[model samples]
Target: MTALPRNVPSSTDPHHLPGVRWLRSSYSTGANNCVETTRPAAGPWAGLLAVRDSKDPAGPALLFSPESWSGFTAAFH
Candidate 1:
């Protein structure tokens, strides 16, 4: 298996996946605390989850493989 790439660009990388729209959680509305997310347009990470802080759109993003994102969501639910 190939090693994952590091030092990805802040906005153009998974941190800001090109063409992948960002969305804020419905739970947020005029609140200081909110989470935003996006996903790849194609490839293995096509549907993988990319998360970041709403307060900092240009900040580093947390990439989670599809399965990992699902498990995280399930565990919290």
Candidate 2:
């Protein structure tokens, strides 16, 4: 079987993902307490979505597959 690449960032350091464009939801309040997501356009992490806490842009991020992210949002809807 082929081994899967490590999609998640090694740490909560935003610097680890330099150049990634993190985007927060339009519904986010001005409080700056929301989660942001970005897709790695290139590299081993490409195709995976990265999510991080808006309060801590330099913090670690959690990676998810497109299908998983869709199911997650669907559950809330």
Candidate 3:
């Protein structure tokens, strides 16, 4: 697996990321099959972005650097 960024939180339970405001893209469809993202406002995870499947709020979250996430999303734009 690819290595995650320093200070990034990796958890099997989304609840591990407390105080995060998970939000789906405005372009998401009503089907609710989109992913959600949140940048931790405080704690050790602050500054890193957390992402999880909207359909599975209690599932694992993948962490990424803001730059990394920008690069990934830029590919589709």
Candidate 4:
């Protein structure tokens, strides 16, 4: 299993995270069923990747390290 990122912040609320611009996958269509990801450039959550459901922007997101995320997603391949 992959390791979690260091300094994981307590706030998982997507809106509360500062200066984040969520991005959707290029493979995503307008259906809004896929997930959105953002890399916080500043604040406590910076240096970690944040992901949230496309259907709920106001909902909480899960944070992951770049390596950890890759390990998690690699299972699909």
TM-score of each: 0.71, 0.77, 0.76, 0.78
Ranking by lDDT: 4, 3, 2, 1
Q: In angstroms, how far off is 63's CA in candidate 3?
A: 0.7
| lDDT of model 1, residue 22 | 81
Clashes of 3: 0
| Per-residue C-alpha lDDT of model 1 across residues 1-77, encoded as one tens digit per residue | 12232223337554346667788999988674898887778644466677887888777777777666777778878
- lDDT pick, better of 1 and 3: 3
Runs with alpha carbons beyond 4 Å of true place in candidate 1: 1-16, 43-45
Model 3 alpha-carbon miss at residue 9, Å: 8.4
Top candidate when judged by lDDT against the true structure: 4
Clashing pairs in 4: none
| TM-score-best of 2 and 3 | 2
Better of 2 and 4 by lDDT: 4
- Angstrom error of the Cα, residue 18, model 1: value is 1.3
Q: After superposition, which runs of candidate 3 have C-alpha atoms over 4 Å from their true positions?
A: 1-15
Cα lDDT tens digits for candidate 3, 1-77: 13454433434344467677788978789687888888887676778788887777776778887888888788889
* Residue 3 in candidate 3, Cα distance off native in Å: 6.0
